[model samples]
Target: MKTLILTTAALALSAGAALAESHAQTVRLGTEGAYPPYNFLNDAGEVDGFEREVGDELCARAELTCEWVTNDWDSIIPNLVSGNYDTILAGMSITDERDEVIDFTQNYYPPAASAYAAPSEDVDLTGGVVSAQATTIQAGHVADSGAALLEFATPDEAVAAVRNGEADAIFADKDFLVPIVEASGGELVFVGDDVPLGGGLGVGLRESDGALRDTLDAAIQSMKDDGSLNELIVKWFGEDAQTFE
Candidate 1:
């Protein structure tokens, strides 16, 4: 998982506090439509990807009407709190610090490893200008790795920095980076060990939305038991991705 950082945002939002809501009739799944395999907009300019498929299935299993909402990653949680969406299915990782601001259903995607990519394998991954999407766990990791962290608003921007020689390498989820490296055709190569981060990816909910949490959690559990979730993981991320039994 090595997603964006969590330690910073929890201080601003309280997780697990008492609040009330009527039973949900419809739920909005919020996502950052930029991260591929996990999530990305399709050629039709619509929400389309693994999470979209999974979210739609979860909605069907829960007997709730679900709609997709695209949001900037940095403000996703805030918008959820503001009621712009009912649930966050944006490839968010479950973690202690984030759990302080919002509740998470059980993980759908198992913990994934993060990695670095550069124009050459000889690139210095531990130092120099390393790029990462801001607020991602990779960025935090880079900050602590003694590298000069060059953060971008989106993952594409971070990767672009590496391509443009603005950065020595780009650090991000290996699952997310694998395709980029494969398609680079010698333009880029894997540069370092893969680092596992985050507990796993899950649907996020406000602390008060226990009922909705239960509904989505049950749907996820059912999918896991029947191997549907694993099937989806394979379809989107290839069989090499971490998946539940």
Candidate 2:
């Protein structure tokens, strides 16, 4: 009698957990609300920017209820794996190393170039001390290129290294650096060739979450087919920014 009672309780708990998961169909879309043009907190202190626009449209088209979630870049992937959020819609590039740990939706934004930025046009890139956001592809690139790689927790801090003369230059996304260089009024300038990195930007998901991945993949394909993806990229990063077909 006790064995039967225990089995029934187990079944009840399994059903309850399943019910909770179904109720959780209200997806949580995670992003680092610090990368501007891609994502950032607006003056209203709420998540805003390009990925925000894209994610909202995706949820609407997929007919899924989703809420925006802000997380730091370093912990972003691990949190998705741990179920803190259902998806990561940050401007994360699709790469093999990342793919080994998580599945990705099809590319929404094409691969962007990484470039060096400095206070002057004549900064040494190959052998100079350079800064990049910690744990990013740019950081790896700088480390591999014989440049002294100084990494920071955030993009702003990486740029601050160059501004404060702690580093000779900073390497980051061209689209990101272009705005800063222009806004710097000659305070900062681009140096060296623009290096293309990664495959392209895609939505990050847990490897076991196949159903959720399919839903978002379909939504991305729909956006690409309708030209809306290209429109959004151009809207945020300008006409020169990489866009999907």
- Over 1-245, each residue of candidate 2 has an lDDT whose tens digit, in order, gives 64664454345444434543676667899999998888999999999999999999887766677899999999999999999998998889999999999999887789989899999888878788999998889999999999889999999999999999999999998877888999998999889889999988899999997766666776776677668989998999987777764
What would the TM-scores of all predictions be?
A: 0.89, 0.89
Worst ten in a row by lDDT for model 2: 8-17
RMSD over all Cα atoms, model 1: 7.9
Task: Flag clash pairs in model 1.
Answer: 1-112, 3-137, 4-135, 4-136, 4-137
Backbone clash total, candidate 1: 5
Native-referenced Cα lDDT, model 1 = 0.83
Worst-scoring 10-residue span by lDDT in model 1: 11-20
**lDDT value, residue 126 of candidate 1:** 72
lDDT of 2 at 136: 88
